[model samples]
Target: MPRPPARPRLTILDVARDAGVSKTSVSRYFGPERSLLSESMRTRIEASISRLGFYPDRIASSLRGRRTGLIGMLVADMRNPFTVAMIHGAEQACRARGYSLVVCNTDSDDLLEQRHLDVLQGYNVEGLVVNTRGHSVAPLVARFEAGLPMVMVDRHLPGLACDMVGLDNAQAMHLAMTHLAEQGYRKVLMVTPPIPGISSREERTACFESEALLSGLESELFEVDLDNEPARLGERLAGWLDEAPACRGAILTGNGVVNLAVCQALHQLMPAPLERTGLLGIDELEWCALVGPGISTVEQPVGAMGEEAIIRLLTRIEGDAEAPVHRTFEATLNVRGSTARVD
Candidate 1:
C-alpha cells in the first residue's frame, strides 16, 4: 500500500495566527465571554475556525472551567414524533448557545431511566431535560435537590418541583371536546394509554372527562394496552362505534401514541365509514393529512416547547434561584375532513 499524508494538527495557535488575533481573543471567542469581543474579531475567529477545521476539545475546555458545554436530555420514548420534534428544537437551541446535547431514551422503563440519569450525571452534564415515564422519582428528586439544573418536558415528576415546559393539557382537551361538540358529535370516546403515573396522560384524561360534561357531550374513556393485545383496541373501538348513535359520535386521542393505536383500529375497521364517526387527536403527525378524511389534530407547539425547556434549564444552570415555573404552551387546532359533520 502507498503511504498516505498525515493531517495537520490544528490548534488555538493556528486559529489565532490565521485570524490575525491573539490566542486569548480566540479562546474568548469560544467561551461565554465572546460577547465581550468586537463583532469583527468574533467574525474573523469564526471564519478562521471554519477554514482550518480546528475543533476545540470540549473536555479540555471544561477542565479549565466549570462548564462542560454539555446538556443532557432524558426522553421517555424516542420513537414518538412529539419527542423527536422536541429533541430537534432543544438541540438547535443548545447549539446556538454553544453547547452540545446528550440524549438518552428510557423506553418508558423506570430502571432504564435511573440508569440513564446515573450516566448523565457521571458525564457531568451542565443541565438535564427530563421527559420521564413518571414511574420513579427518587433519583430525579435527589439530583434536583443536589443543585443540578433540570427541567421537565411534557411529563412532571411527583414531589420533584422542577421547571416544566409542555402543552396546556387542559386547553388541549377543551379544544378537542369543543371541536367535536361543534361538529355535532354529542357522544365522545377518549382513547389513551394507561394513566397511572404519567401526569400528561392523567391531566388530559381528567380534562376530557370534566370538560365533556361542561361541553354537554357524553364521554367515555378507554385505556388501551399497547403492549399486550393491541388488536383488542380495534375490538373496543368497534364496540364504541357500534354503540354510539349514528352521526352523533366522535373519537378523541390523548396523545400521539394513542392517536397511532386509534388510527390502527380505525384502519382495521375500515369500510364501516368514518363519515358518521368523527376523529380528532392531540399531537399532529406527518401522515394525518394522508389518512382517511385527513384526521383532525390539535397541533402542539413542540419545537417551541423544546426550545423553552432548553432555555429554562440553562437559566437554572446559570444560577437562577427563583421559584420553579410551569410554563404551558397552547395547542392549535387543525380542522380537517375527519371532524366534518355528516349530513
Candidate 2:
C-alpha cells in the first residue's frame, strides 16, 4: 500500500499571518507571562487559532524552561457532593487565572493515591491540591519534604507543616451543640461512618464530645458500616427515642452520606419520629428542604474552601515563602421544624 504525504503541524506563525498580527502577539496570548493585550486582538487571535485548529507544542515549551500552566488536584471520592462542589470551584478558579486543571480521583484507595501523585509530579505540575484520607500517604510526605507547592483540603497531613483550607469543625460542633441544647435536646446521638486515618472525622468526633459536655448535654456516638445492616442505625435511633423523654432527644449526623443513611434508617419508624426527636446534620444536602418538615444542618462552605485552597497553592507557586497557613471557612446553620421542640 502506498503511504499518503503527512500534513505539516500548524505553527504560531501561521496563526499570526491568518489573524494579521505579529508572532510575538500570538506568543504572548499563549504564554504564562501574561500581558494585557486588547480584547479585539485577543478575539481575533482566538478566532484564527480556532479556524486553523492550532494546538500549541507544550512539550517543546516546557523543554525550553517555560511554565506549563497545569495544576493538579487529588480527590478521595467523586460521588460525594462535597467533592463535586470543591472540584467545580477549583475549575472556576483555574479558568479565571488562565491555567488548566488535572483532577485525580483515588476513591480512598492507597495504591491509587500513590500512583496519581506520581503521575501528577511526572507531568511537572506547578502545584497540587490534596483531599485524600492520609492512609498510605508516605509518598505525599516525601513530596512535601521536597518543597512542592501544595495544599491539603480539610486537614493537614499527619505532623507535616502543610497549608490547609477547610470548614471550621470546632466552630461547627459548638454551633450544632448549642442549637440542639436551645431546642431542649438534652441528649444527642451522632452516627458516623468508619473513622480512623481521616483527621477531619476525628476532629469532628472530639469536638462533638467536648461540646456536648460543655453545653450540659449527654451525647453518644456510633461508628457503623454503611455497606452492612444500615437498619442497625434505626435500631440505635429507636433506643435513643426510648431512653430520652419526648422532644428531649435529637440525632446529629456526621456528614451528608451519614445524614442520608440515618434518614433511611429512621424512615421505617415513620409518623411520630420526625416530630418527636430533633434532627441536624453537618453537611447540607440539596434535598434537605424537600424532606418532611425539612432537615436541619450546619452547612460547610465547600466551594469557598476549594477556591481558597487554589489561591493558597498559587501563592506558593509564585514563590511566596512563609510558614504554613491554616484557613478555615465557616458553616451556616439551617434551622427547620425538625429541630423545633413540641411543647
lDDT for each candidate structure: 0.86, 0.85
**Residue-wise lDDT of candidate 2 within 156-225, one digit each (tens)?**
7776677999888999999999999888788898888787878898999999999999999998999887
lDDT of 1: 0.86
- How much is the lDDT of residue 127 in candidate 1? 89
Give the poorly placed runs of model 1, Cα more than 4 Å off.
1-10, 32-43, 50-53, 245-247
- Taking the tens digit of each residue's C-alpha lDDT, what string does model 1 give over 190-280? 8888889888888889999999999998888988778887877888888876766563888888788888878777767866446557889
**TM-score for each predicted model, relative to the true structure:** 0.91, 0.93
Q: Give the TM-score of candidate 2.
A: 0.93
lDDT of 1 at 86: 98
Which runs of model 2 end up more than 4 angstroms from their true locations? Answer: 31-35, 228-231, 244-247
Q: After superposition, how far is residue 105 of candidate 1 from its true place, in Å?
A: 1.3
